[model samples]
Target chain A: MVRKRQILVIGNNTNGCTPKHEKIAYDIGSEIAKSDSVLISGGLGGVMEASSHGAHDANGFTVGIIPQDDASFANEFCDVVIPTGMGLTRDYLNALSADGVIIVGGGSGTLSEACASYMHKKPMVAIKNLGSSVDPYIDGYIDHRKNIKIIGVDTAQEAVKKILELITA
Target chain B: MVRKRQILVIGNNTNGCTPKHEKIAYDIGSEIAKSDSVLISGGLGGVMEASSHGAHDANGFTVGIIPQDDASFANEFCDVVIPTGMGLTRDYLNALSADGVIIVGGGSGTLSEACASYMHKKPMVAIKNLGSSVDPYIDGYIDHRKNIKIIGVDTAQEAVKKILELITA
Candidate 1:
């Protein structure tokens, strides 16, 4: 079987902002899974759990890039847990391995991972105003005045559609 | 002035989580700061922001290890931002530069960074339930547990005190 391209969901893992962000994050991840995309995450809680859960609920494949050998840290929804044995540096591999990236409401860690996606020239879509403590870091090139389609959308479905358009176009 | 020891806080950067987790994370960082500790992080969200803010609020310093050239991604609380321009690999340096590591609640990305900490033999403390989503992995340690301090604390204050007691002792 031809393997489906994995779309990594990079997000913030903050307790203060996660409860509200989880709703939209889950919607986007679920939409992506419903579209047959394999979900990948750092494999724990917050957006990772929501995204992993969304993909699993839709009967889609999910891969969690975990930091250690233990499976308990793997979010409950992850189908394949790959223990990186690398620690926080595993975040680098997560960003590097993805076909593209979707940045939901995020903070520094998400921003760092998103920068990785941008640096690797991977297609990226940042979901803005999802109730993160820190505002989304918008690339100047993708500003509203510009026609550059490093798309930004409010809903999950639209974000996925825009990502597909950018990738396939 | 005696320079504060830099304690690197490494872990997953998912969407913001709970205020309780943030409070715990900050409590640990603040405790470290009170001891003249300089906080370090991947320069982004979740525990990183919470910890950095805690240290900064305590009149301590913070350094953010950023993967991109732009320092805008650094949290507002960070006193200094070191742009690595090396994408996700920057996380490795964050792990390498720390005097020790305090893992707040995290996923795989945090796990990966934690692995780097372990590999380097840096003293590391996981805030029990609050640090990383290290589930089954936490249970598999048949040996070599002596080198790592796994403290199951209900609050960040205890976690910080434990980390200080271990590294300083």
Candidate 2:
């Protein structure tokens, strides 16, 4: 049996982001479902919840890798909740488990996850967000390694499209 | 019930470290076992193995948080092996699960664990070593946060003692 491809979406939590960001995340999740890939996320609020909600609504498989020990801590939409009990370090776990990654209107935690994914050689793409923590790496590489540039996208469709293509290639 | 205190030791795998470093790590694990604290590490070779070996010989509990998906990857001395399957990012899981952290001779992976632990506000200390990657933070905090000082100790005994005291107090 072929293991399902898991695409991770990392971003701001319930706070510090705009409604537009949530919509994009939701769309990304929908796109992931349509492509027949599994949706994976931090399994908290904000973008994580929004994406999972979108996927759930679309009958897509969704997995939430949460930092807390309690499985119930996962957002209601997560079909599979893996409570890491590792606090914020769970960020790396999500990045590690995914074939590719995406960022949407994130702060410090998002940047850390993005950076960790790059360090581990995971391909990534980001939705363009003004003043977002990930702005520096949008359409560019995180550092000198330049292993795989963090591609920037204008729409949720393109974000998933680019990541799938990048990882498959 | 008072939970067992889990003390983590992070450091180089099997390479780039001296035998003297391994001896110190082993002694530190022995001290942790003697104090009835559970020992934790990356669960691979070098310092991780030596420390687990010391703790196991002392009949102490040892938990190895390994990076691979397979539990068999852990060093034999580990009593409990948590196969994270998150690759190098599993470094953060070790730091997050520990009440305190001790750094033996290490490289970039160790530094990442140390930094993540500090970010999550875990007390930490290091065995003083000349020109180790952790030398810069030996007597200071990782960054300006100075949330809790990363104490430096001369011997394994001191390292364990200082970290225990810092975490409890």
Candidate 3:
């Protein structure tokens, strides 16, 4: 049996994200779902919510690595809520769990996730013009010596395509 | 009855930290223990290991928020190991569980913890010259308008003292 790909989506919680970011995240979610891949996120508001919403609309499975121990904090679109009382540190789990990561607009939290993804050596694709805190480091891998690279793309469709190619390659 | 103060120590895991960082972390741990406060860390290696060792020597309670689900991942100095199974996302719990935070030399993981502490409104103190990734944001709090501040000090003793004052105030 072929293993279903798990694509982790990292983004702003809500207050920091713009409507354009939300649309991109939603599209990314939909694309991942259409490809028969599972969508995973931090399971809160903003980008997480938007992406999960898109995936759910497409009848795709969505998992949320919630910081709280209870599933109550999970967004409405999350189908599988893994309540990890670990809090923001859960970004490591979010990154490690993914076959690939899709980054949207975010602040410090999103930046943390991006760093975690790089550290874990996961393939990452950042949607361009998100103005995320991870932007500063996106141009290069974690360091000159590391093989990990974060590909940049303009649209969600391109991000999905690139991520699929990366993971499959 | 007074609750025992919990001090969160943020630093790099073994692979990313230096001997100087380990020494400073050890001193901070010792100071925290002598002050009758519990030491908290991510519980992997490097600064976390050194600090936990110092706290153990001083007969202080040590808590490690382990990223893995198994307790075996926790360092020897950790008196209590909370197997978060949440990976790096556990940084949020490590920050929120503390009454205050002490930053030693750190990398991406430490940066995440510092950001989490700021977002949670926890008092923080960075040991100067530790070369932590949080240096960029240490001067100002997470928000310019917020009253929260991360005090910087030259010595471990001064850091402990300042943190106590901030928490007490």
Query: Runs in model 3 with CA error above 4 Å?
Result: A56-61, A64-93, A141-147, B56-61, B65-90, B141-149
Ten-residue stretch with the least lDDT total in model 2 chain A: A140-149
* Proportion of native contacts kept per candidate: 0.10, 0.04, 0.27
The number of the candidate with the highest TM-score is: 3
Q: How much DockQ does model 3 earn?
A: 0.28
Q: What local lDDT does model 2 show for residue B6?
A: 92
- How well does model 2 score by local distance difference test? 0.83
Model 3, B22-61: lDDT tens digits are 8888988999999999999888899999999989998898
**What TM-score do all the candidates reach, one by one?**
0.52, 0.59, 0.81
All candidates: DockQ: 0.07, 0.08, 0.28
lDDT of 3 by residue, A18-59 (tens): 889889999999999999999999999999999999999988
lDDT of 1: 0.69
Instruction: Evaluate residue A78 in candidate 3 and report its C-alpha lDDT on the 0 to 100 scale.
Output: 97
Q: What is the lDDT of residue A55 in candidate 1?
A: 79
Candidate order by decreasing lDDT = 3, 2, 1
Evaluation by TM-score, superior candidate among 1 and 3? 3
TM-score of chain B of each: 0.85, 0.96, 0.95
